[model samples]
Target: MNVIHAENIIAGELNEFEQAIRLLKRLHECKARQYLDSWCKRGEAGVYHNVMRKLDRMGNIYQPYADHETEITDWFPLVDCIADTAVYNLKWLGRMGQWHPEALASLTAYVCEQERLQAKEK
Candidate 1:
């Protein structure tokens, strides 16, 4: 999943939440769904489920990974969704004054390149 690459991406400058989201998006795009699902599962009884519930209680949104059995067979849509969500979240953070706009724009451009690479596979 190249999780380390994802972790190193933020350059240790962004907020923790931003870093986490970037890592999550990278994992999603890299087809590390199982890893993500596993990551979310670490509490008491059903820790992951409990964490999700707690996040829900706090109004923090968490996008659940697609269940392979019920998920669409196509990969493009999934990649597109991941890219779109990351870009959207980046823009949102910028708009909310949580991140520098110029920095966000640069990140978006890099993510766009990732999108282009994904598109070429199809």
Candidate 2:
């Protein structure tokens, strides 16, 4: 199975889809270029893949869909973990909302990492 890394796919940052598009442009520089390229053509088989293909063709810059905020929340590592739960619970909560719980949690974890990096800042 081909799994896209969160960082590679979205970086778990950039609340704006447009900014996410810009971030994608820099992914080519990642060490996993070959791995990513292998699946670029396979996106046609699925909706997500198709969107990815569209993004790829659009050159790493795209505006979010009008419903992006209501659909996909900011991705974070922790939130990513529980995102599915949050998404599922939305209906139970009687509110059609997008809450990336795991992603948010992961983002917090990432923040901790960033703090560590900052400690070594020169």
Candidate 3:
């Protein structure tokens, strides 16, 4: 998914951290589906398992944010974790020529914009 789609999901009305996670989850699902389709078409279904594993790893990184006790004060650290995982996932996808550069760029831009906006509130 692109930044516009992410923005639409966020609707600029929720907590910034929550919105960011939601967008990331959506993008992860989209990327997973893209990889699945590409691998299937190539008759390399075995490789799809690797993609799922990476996605699962990303999900593990997101677990803390999924916890109800996570505070707003934890936003930056959580975002950093997500950024790291996303970069790792993108790099592997790139090696396989399955990466969506535009989507990655858009998501990065959106995250930066959110960070800026949230900083202004403090």
Candidate 4:
């Protein structure tokens, strides 16, 4: 996993972290049920558990930022954690041959948007 140090985060970059959290929450709520249903029907509950686990990890990583609104330093790890979880979840879904088009699109869009923001920073 790539670690993003707090000192490396630029001013205003925390907005991207906030956006990522929102996107992850939206993706989880929108797709978790469908994924759970599909995985359960296919007797692949383990895969659903993995996906939800990543989402839970993301929530845990973001909780600090959500709780301390003024503490932008905490956003550094949150950004990397969100990125890692999103990428892992997408890859896991793909590997399981359970990719939902809409969910994939949302995840892809989040990655692309994050990349764009990072590029602008550089």
> Which candidate ranks first by lDDT, i.e. highest?
4
**Deviating ranges (above 4 Å) for candidate 1:** 1-72, 98-122
Q: What are the TM-scores, per candidate, against the unseen true structure?
A: 0.26, 0.21, 0.29, 0.35
The window of 10 residues in a row where model 1 has the poorest summed lDDT is 59-68
Q: Which residue pairs collide in model 4, if any? A: none
Q: lDDT of model 2 at residue 107?
A: 60
Clashing pairs in 3: none
> Which candidate comes out best when scored by TM-score?
4
Model 4 lDDT on a 0 to 1 scale: 0.61
After superposition, the stretches of candidate 3 with alpha carbons farther than 4 Å from their true spots are 1-65, 98-122
The residue ranges of model 4 lying beyond 4 angstroms of the native Cα positions read: 1-44, 96-122
- lDDT of each residue in 1-122, candidate 1, tens digit only: 32234536656567666766776666555654444444224322344344344445333222333333343455555544445445444434544333356866787889999999999999
Question: Candidates' lDDT values, in order?
Answer: 0.51, 0.42, 0.58, 0.61
Worst 10 residues of 4 by lDDT: 1-10
Order the candidates by TM-score, highest first — what do you get? 4, 3, 1, 2
Q: In angstroms, what RMSD does candidate 3 have relative to the true structure? A: 14.9
> Could you tally the backbone clashes for each prediction?
2, 15, 0, 0
Candidate 4, 29-98: lDDT as tens digits: 6666566444344344555675577678778776666898545665656655665467445546564444
Which of 1 and 2 is ahead in TM-score?
Answer: 1
